[model samples]
Target: MFNERIHRLLKEISEAFADRRDPFNNEWLSKNDVSIDELHQLTGAVSSILDGFLAAPKETQVLLLSVGMAASSFRG
Candidate 1:
């Protein structure tokens, strides 16, 4: 279930990035200058990480989410 959800989220993010007419999208891509292939590779990496998490036990899954939350908070 988590794997599927993460895949969907990555797909949504990819679609948002690919749609060039979006103002924020344009500015973001312009600033970052990521190639299409690089973005595809990143999406693949995200899927692999999600797969690893899904294979872990339930307790570990919660721990992973907690770590991710902390990391995101730090980024902000």
Candidate 2:
């Protein structure tokens, strides 16, 4: 049973990185000093935040966009 569990876990991990050309691949992580787990967590957080933004009322979205634009302009 333990060996079967290990095999399944390995398979899942292998499938997770099946796309080598993706920026989230091992090479990119190594170059950026990031771990795969950390990348996964950040990706999840960003996805959740974006989902909230998308589901928000249109006026709220517009206000957020305006604020974001203002912030970007101040960076220059």
lDDT of each: 0.61, 0.59
69 in model 2: Cα distance from truth in Å? Answer: 0.8
**Model 2 C-alpha lDDT per residue in residues 1-75, reported as the tens digit of each score:** 224533443333334444334545676557656656656655665467689889999999999889766755664
Candidate 2 residues lying further than 4 Å off, grouped into runs, are 1-28
What TM-score against the true fold does each predicted structure earn? 0.55, 0.57
Candidate 1 C-alpha lDDT tens digits along 1-76: 3455445445445455445334236565455565676556656766787899999999999999898667555643
Cα lDDT over the full model 1: 0.61
TM-score of predicted model 1? 0.55
Candidate with top TM-score is 2
